[model samples]
Target: MSIQVGDTLPDVEIRVVSNGIEEGRTGPLFAGRKVVLFAVPGAFTPTCSNRHLPGYVQHLAQFQARGVEVMCLAVNDAYVMQAWAASQNVPPELLMLADGNGNFTKAMGLELDGNAYGMGLRARRFALYAENGVVKALQVEAPGEFRVSTAEAILEALA
Candidate 1:
């Protein structure tokens, strides 16, 4: 089953670029914090690049004003995520995490098969509001839908 709002986030290894290359765990990242974690199917995809990611980047300060750490996650590798962040010119405060092995995505039961497009296993588009490692709210979109996971929607929910 997919993770529910009341579920504690599972500890899964993910990658990030810091100093050089580094591996980190979700549990530690969410520990003692309120996080706005959003996932996309892949990096550099049209919808993801143009809309999804830009929404977060644009409304980042609003999230932070509410004491939320904004994060963008995808099933791509650390290198790809890092490069995408740079290309998007995302602020440093927004965390870009890579679920390269799909471990975190599978653990959350959010993995999507994109083999038809040769993308392999990837994350479905979704967003979660988590606090202290426990999920407070979760919004998952239907396939090819981008309605509820947008930054504006989540910000409205918070308000």
Candidate 2:
């Protein structure tokens, strides 16, 4: 089953580029803080690059104003995530995380099989709000849709 509102996020290893690519875990990242993490199927994909990520970038400050940290995740490698972040001019406050092996994605039951499109296991387009490691809200989109997982939608959910 997919992770739900009361679920404590699985502690799984992930990669983030801090001076260089470094290992981190989900549990500590979400512990003692409110976080809004949004996942895309891949980095630099058309919809993700043009719309999904930009929405978050534009509204990042608004999220922070509510005491929530914003994060963008993809199944790509840490190098690709870093490049994408630089290309997008993403602020340092908005974390760019890589789930290269999809361990965390699978653990959350949010893995998307994109073999038909030549993409491998990937993360479904979704976003979740958590407080102190416990999920408080989740919005998952339907296949080929991009409706509920946008930054505005999550902000509305928070309200």
For model 2, the stretches where C-alpha displacement exceeds 4 angstroms are none
- Candidate lDDT scores, in order, read 0.92, 0.93
Q: What residue pairs are clashing in model 2?
A: none
The reply for model 1, stretches above 4 Å from the true place, is 18-20
Query: Model 1, 49-149: lDDT tens per residue?
Result: 99999999999999999999998899999999998998998888888989999999999999999999899999999999999999999999999999999
Best-performing candidate as measured by lDDT: 2
How high is the lDDT of residue 91 in model 2?
86
- What are the RMSD figures for all models against the true structure? 1.1, 0.9
For candidate 2, lDDT tens digit of each residue in 57-133? 99999999999999998999999999998888888888988999999999999999999999999999999999998
Cand. 2 Cα-lDDT: 0.93
Taking all chains together, each candidate's TM-score versus the true structure is 0.97, 0.97
